[model samples]
Target: MTAFGISAFGAYVPRLRLDRAIIADAHRWAMPGLRSAAKGSRAFANWDEDAITMAVEAARDALADRDLSKVAALRLASTSLPFADLQNAAIVARAIDAPHQIASSDVAGSQRAGTSALLQALKGTQAELVIGSDHPSAKPASVQELTF
Candidate 1:
């Protein structure tokens, strides 16, 4: 018999949202439609916030009742990592105080990075803490950016 379980899950949405009208006004674009008009309230990470910070906050919340010593691995997924060479997941693991021996990895470059990490976790390979987040950028007045 085998049992695979979700040890924890957490999310952190930013407090501030940039309205769609602001984007439209900034780009001098005419209002598109009701859906497009409402698309503007996209969340924004604070000046002090970054992928690592958001991951740490979510990890803290997810692992609040669990012992990090038991977290055999940590996986972070983000498209807005602060550095290209540095491993962002390692930073998050350290921030959350995971055991020194635990494995850590990062998945980046796309919005689906988090989903990919989750797939790995479900395989019961090594990851125990998988964190996925994105602060994806879009051109002002672009519909894609507005929705995200």
Candidate 2:
């Protein structure tokens, strides 16, 4: 049988960008060699923008050319889920007006959770929509946080 393919894809980078100078100044003491290039810019989530909103934007783009009713399942992968216990995938499904019976769930914790969710969706029987996003934090002067 033929395997599934991506119908569409979308990415949303927040409008606000924190200058490298500010970051470098704040972390100059902590990170000796923290330069602008070393510490790339950061995207700031707007007041109303959360994981759910970002996921909705991505899902909307992914469903652009497809029928919402055809989406039977939605898998959301995120390490920065706004709510600890709530199902963010359901919120994304509702936002996109997907079928009422569509299966929805969240995969979180590790960065690898994205791959896990994708693998699970691909192995499943239903037509699936998988969305992954991350907003990981690091120490103020940590290189990992600055690079991303």
Candidate 3:
């Protein structure tokens, strides 16, 4: 039987970080509960960075010192995709200069979007590049803002 498995992997976290304390302090006056969760910081993307850009960087990191021509498929997962109607994965593939013949797609909608894509890739019979990236949108002073 043929074998399919992950040979390499890479991840990218933005340089900017938003301290949970900052988030808590902003809302603690109204929601003192936030103070309990304000221990660590979360990655904050820059104005120029988005799901697509981060995915590209991670893919590049994984593909570093390797041949891009061998990549057979690309899958990008996120809850904060820049475009709702565009094929985001194609953009990522193009950004990485991945070959034109490879398959590419975007996955989103559910919180498990990334996990689902990863599971599918692992079960499939082709060499796939799966990336899970998110920049969730949360309302100010809301629980999501402090936790997400």
Give per-model CA RMSD. 2.5, 2.1, 1.7
Backbone clash count, each prediction separately = 1, 0, 0
Q: Kindly list the per-residue Cα lDDT of model 1 for residues 1-148, writing each as its tens digit.
A: 4457675688888888888767766665454543446543778888888878888998888888787776788889988888798988888888888889988899887778988988888888444899986766666556765676
User: Per-residue alpha-carbon lDDT of model 2 for 87-119, expressed as tens digits?
Assistant: 888888888888899999899988788899999
Query: TM-score of the candidate numbered 2?
Result: 0.86
Mark the regions of model 3 whose C-alpha exceeds 4 Å error after superposition: 1-3
Residue 137 displacement (Å), model 2? 2.2
Model 1, stretches more than 4 Å misplaced? 29-35, 125-127
**Candidate achieving the largest lDDT:** 3
Superposition error at 116 for model 1 (Å): 1.5
Give Cα distance to truth, residue 144, candidate 2, Å.
2.9
Q: Write down the TM-score of every candidate.
A: 0.84, 0.86, 0.89
Error of 1 at 128 (Å): 0.5
Order the candidate numbers by lDDT, best to worst: 3, 2, 1
